[model samples]
Target chain A: MSEQGPAFDLSYVANLARLELSEEDVAMFEPQLQGILSYMEKLDAIDVSGIEPTAHANPVLNVTRPDEVCPSLPVEEALRNAPKSANDQFVVPKVVE
Target chain B: MSLASQTIKGLQTLLEKKEIQPKEIIDSVAEAAAVRDGAIGGYLGLDQELAHRDAEEISGGVLAGIPIGIKDLLNVKGQPCGCASKILSNYIAPYDATSIAKLRASGGIPFGRANMDEFAMGSSNENSSIKPVHNPWDLERIPGGSSGGSAAIVAADEAIAALGSDTGGSIRQPAAFCGCVGLKPTYGRVSRFGLTAFASSLDQIGPLTKTVEDAAILLGAISGGDKNDSTCLDESVPDYVADLQGDIKGMKLGMPKEFFGEGIDPAIRASVEEAAKQFESLGAEIVEVSLPHTEQAVAVYYIIATAEASANLARFDGVRYGYRAPDAENLGEQYAKSRAQGFGNEVKLRILLGTYVLSSGYYDAYYLRAQKLRTLIRQDFTSAFETVDAIIGPVSPIAPFKIGENASDPLAMYLADIYTISANLAGICGLSLPCGYMTPSDGQRELPIGLQILGAPFDEGKVLKLGHNFEQSTEWHQRRPSLG
Candidate 1:
């Protein structure tokens, strides 16, 4: 970690985000991201010790729907945009290997 | 005037009178768009045959035979809702978004696919993976984005009116840049059921139109409670068009000192202040109000919006829909490769920023603090509302800049959003209409300037009324760009 910058590793964060970035992306984005993070650091100066964080603008309660079944997308329509599908199921690489 | 250039109300009246058939209007618009949009690049595609057929069937609906442009972000059933990104280029919407359903029921023909910033991420349309949208007023300048194409198409008269999603000023800023009327309804005022999510908490879909009346009419058509979008308020939708009349007598308009201060371009500040004076003449009182937390809006927005964006966008993985990277060694590699290859630079940067802020170690320091600041920002508006009915300011700090000017500097682009992001953060409604034009230092040509009118949550009627009154007295909305 640098003395004046964030301690978080860029590559580590990118990996967690499931982003595959090249070395050039790393070199270019490191300082840029660092600058933005430092800019956001200004938030620390204002005293927010007592204020509760607002997760959303409106007050929302648990939204529930009736349990009765309704018409859903037909199998063909649901599978229309799938990159790889067979037998109306999305095909994926074997995870158990 | 050409059928394409007419406002929604004008076209609707014409269609109802049977003076012009819907097919003729679509054909005229299609021809004009083909010739002009080649330079403006406002549309991704146009389906005139379907539009013609749909138009012919409609008789006496509210928008009868009037064609409307759908932002590529909104799903119109059986159309390509690309969102102007390569990732979703081939993705066809299997069903209509609830907003589209309402529009169709009102006799609106969703005709053209307008371009946008990739996944609605950037302030300039330059971020579009397909092509950059040019401002109709000056082709050399950018149409402010992520609703760039929507605003540009409306200004150029390629679409009678268009729907745009505003998350951090995507709709209004672009409308301001392109010299049109753009409204962002309160967060829950309009259903977000069909619109692609950017910052789910802040995103709301609204209309970009040539006139305030057109905007009001379009807003009324699409807004109501929806069973699909739970966040959509169940409150009754007001008759915005009917509310457009009447004087602004005894109404107090607040001018936020922070928005009119040092960073604003002198010309834009003058134009907006002049519009305020016009409101004063119309029996409205102008009062100076302070939103002390205004300075913190952009920072708070970047954090919260991007955090929500990261979560909302995670659904675009390779398996179920959209693009999937070929030649991936494993599932993990596939997810990473597909996203990295599919998304544009701005989208990736935002996603990274979001992931970083929401990361374990930094959550309390960045995201949490930002949320706390968000509370303060909302309080500032809530407190100010007690003193004034609405707030007005410059829509953007500066006039439209040359395309590719700020594309390289992300921070500069983010700072431009300072004036417009607060309403979204506060969950209030805001409108931007052409107030005046400013000729640049080069003296080449004048660019349109927007005056932003803001109201409390669900106060869209007030905002539109004020805009309607101002627009009635000004020639700004009447001036059309001389597109070459």
Candidate 2:
């Protein structure tokens, strides 16, 4: 393992994932996250200079569906599970002042 | 024999012959679950009225009247789909997943909510926010997970068969631990429309059944083209049940040397090797092959899967359906507070690791490199398949451990998935069936060992045939666990 590995800023990473972690959570996860990152460093030794990266296992390209109209989930059914819904729309906290 | 103890095929025969009623079977299983599920913890919810209603209308179909367990990770329209996590604790699926719709159309009643590791994130069921599913073979040990409850219920006869999603051995490992047959189809073989995503690329829905034939039946029914999930292939799905009787004569089976090396339980290795010898006696050639990139599978899987997970789970903010923390100042606080409160430790850890790997500064070095390595892993299988019709190995390196044995140690828990992770990475199909059981020298309860058969993409017919032949030659699948 090299000292050049990312410092693994736990709080910064949590915020990136949209997770709010208490200090206790950060303390607990920091070392474990570092261990996993160092373990992942094993991939650097393999010379994959010319190998193509596979995003999906199947060879699917430009899968376009026809523009024909199809029945979709009804708005009421879709919003039925929303924690806060009114007027057939999901109500979210106001972002702007 | 107890009707509840019968396999899906066994019960189907009786149902078709009018010797036993679907209602009777459901009642017995529901009753048994009511009496025995405390020790097993298999079902998160069981709807008796719905089970009865589904049983009342059994007809002439492949899976008629067979009660199948639905893993909580799958959406069973109008049922709670918690994924065994607190985040979605109050969530109710408004529609059936493609597989569930198919199962219902086939007259296979989706009976109950089977438990799983939260968001299908853990190797053991312990990470479940609901409850830990116990191994039917030994209550103190884990039913290997995140498909733990699906395996446990089938093993305990609480359900004739069950549906489970495998992402890094969730289906196979638990099935092996619980002494049943489990299969993860080739990537895109089954539609993943309603399955909550843990890792979209690696996650696949599969069947956990009491017998290979039942697994074949369920797999065949639930698989095919679906417009909803673009990953599902448009290729024709073969009748897996009808194709299960083929002989393996002259077929080449590869035994990867990496699968048998150090860290594997000696007994488990010997058992899997013996299974290979059994294949030899069945006139199949067993060749020793090398998958050099095997060791890096777990490392690459964690990085890629978690990276995808971090992205996928971003949808579960407090705004839409699911659990939302109250008394938040605004949307941002709501998002963080809800996620932090809702997720379990394993989920949180993976999210953190995933976010780190995909974070702007580290994305190319970690995520891209892992994806490249993933290509190498897939090539290993593609090349190996060129020489052999199928590959054989142990499902897990060791038998099921005690409930909390690896709970505190994430790496050890991650290592439990080493043998099963490669197939997912390769986008190939694999099956796990009981090859043998090993009783420890210290006189602990005997544990089931699985023989994993791997086939090329869309080679489920070959895999199921091999499993059927192997099962016919041994008594391992016929053995039942006597649960308290």
Candidate 3:
């Protein structure tokens, strides 16, 4: 990191995002991402010693519903768009040894 | 005028008189789509059979017999809700979005899948993996997006009206580019239940139509409390149609100097200033105001929007739904490879940006700072609204640029949304309507210019009334592009 800004480490962020970028993708995105990050640095000029953060401006607060059991989407409908599903369950690759 | 190009109110009137049938309107839209869609590419797919089937049963509602173009992200049961991303290309919605249910309740048939930026990530439609939507005004120019197709379809008369969601100017910018009316209600004014999440804090679904009254009619149908979305306001929905008929005799409109000054093209600045004069002629007083923090809005938006987007978009992991990579040896490979292979360049980039901003150590620097600045932006609106009924400005700083001209520069593209993005940050209602035209020296066709109208939170009625008065005094709303 320098006075200009922290250098954007493409591989580190891509791994965090769970995206497998190839040489072509890296070549394409690196400079563009750098430019965007630098553009964001302009926000640092404003001094905010005691300002509160706003997640959103909508006035609504916490909402709740009754605890009654309700009918939900059928297994058949829920699994309809899955790439691989069988016996009302989604199939996936195993991660652990 | 052709039935396809007629306003929703115009068509509704004809249907009431028995001068035209419900099926005729659907057929007219289909005919228009057939003739122009090859050039416009606004729709990814149209459900003509389903639309016609619903048209048969259409009766006794404000939108009765009218077909509305559905942006691909909205879940309309049995229709493919692709979001213009390759990952969701094969996914069919199992249920209707709350807004779609309300539309159908009002007899509006959800007709087609309009293309958009994959996950609504970009300001230009070029980010769409399915296909880029072209502005109907000029074939080579880029249509503003991520709701580009929604605006283009309504402008080209392929559909009477369409629904669009705005995170940061997705709906209004495109509407300005394509010469249509786009209204983004205050956050939580409309439910986000079946609408795919982009940025939860800023996302809202609204209408793109040919006239201000048409926007009001469509807004009335989709608004109200929805139990499905907790953030959705339980407040009463006003009669926007009645509001449209009210006079705008002495309303004060704030014109922010930040929007009218440098960075905006001189020609666009002149057109917007001229539009301000027209507002005065219609008995409204224009007062100059300053939103000093306007410059930092775009910077804050990318951080906050992308941070939320990272969390929201992590659901597309190929385990439950959407495109999945085959032959992955392990779960890690499956997650990474499927996303890398299925998602487009822009979507991948935004996800990475979001992930970086929200990463452990950097969160305080990027995401937290943006939130505090967002408070400042919202306060700017709060102070401005105390003295004025609404704020007026330009939608985009320049005419729609050529395809690929600004796509490579993400910052440049994001800056184009400068005027429209602050309202989303502030969570206030904003509308973009055709104000004037720009006759470019490079092209023979005139480009449409839009003036943005901003109102206090949940104050859409006042915005509509002001737009309606300006619309009535001018002939801009009546101007249509000739596909020929």
> By lDDT, who's the top model here?
3
TM-score of each: 0.98, 0.98, 0.98
- Top-down lDDT ranking: 3, 1, 2
Tell me the deviation in Å of residue B415 in model 3: 1.0
lDDT of 1 by residue, B218-244 (tens): 999999988899999888988999999
In model 3 chain B, the worst 10-residue window by lDDT is: B53-62
What TM-score would you give candidate 3 relative to the actual structure?
A: 0.98
Clashing pairs in 2: none
Predicted candidate 3, C-alpha RMSD: 1.1
Tens-digit lDDT track of model 3 for B174-272: 999999999999998999999999999999999999999999999999999898899998879888998888678799999998997788877778888
Task: Name the lDDT value of residue A30 in candidate 3.
Answer: 89
For model 2, the superposed segments whose C-alpha errors exceed 4 Å read: A1-5, B57-59, B441-443
**Tens digit of per-residue lDDT, candidate 1, span A1-97:** 3435677588898888888999989887887787777777766679999998987788679877888888989999999999999998999888785
RMSD of each: 1.2, 1.3, 1.1
Cα lDDT, model 3, residue B350: 84
* Backbone clash numbers for all candidates listed: 0, 0, 0
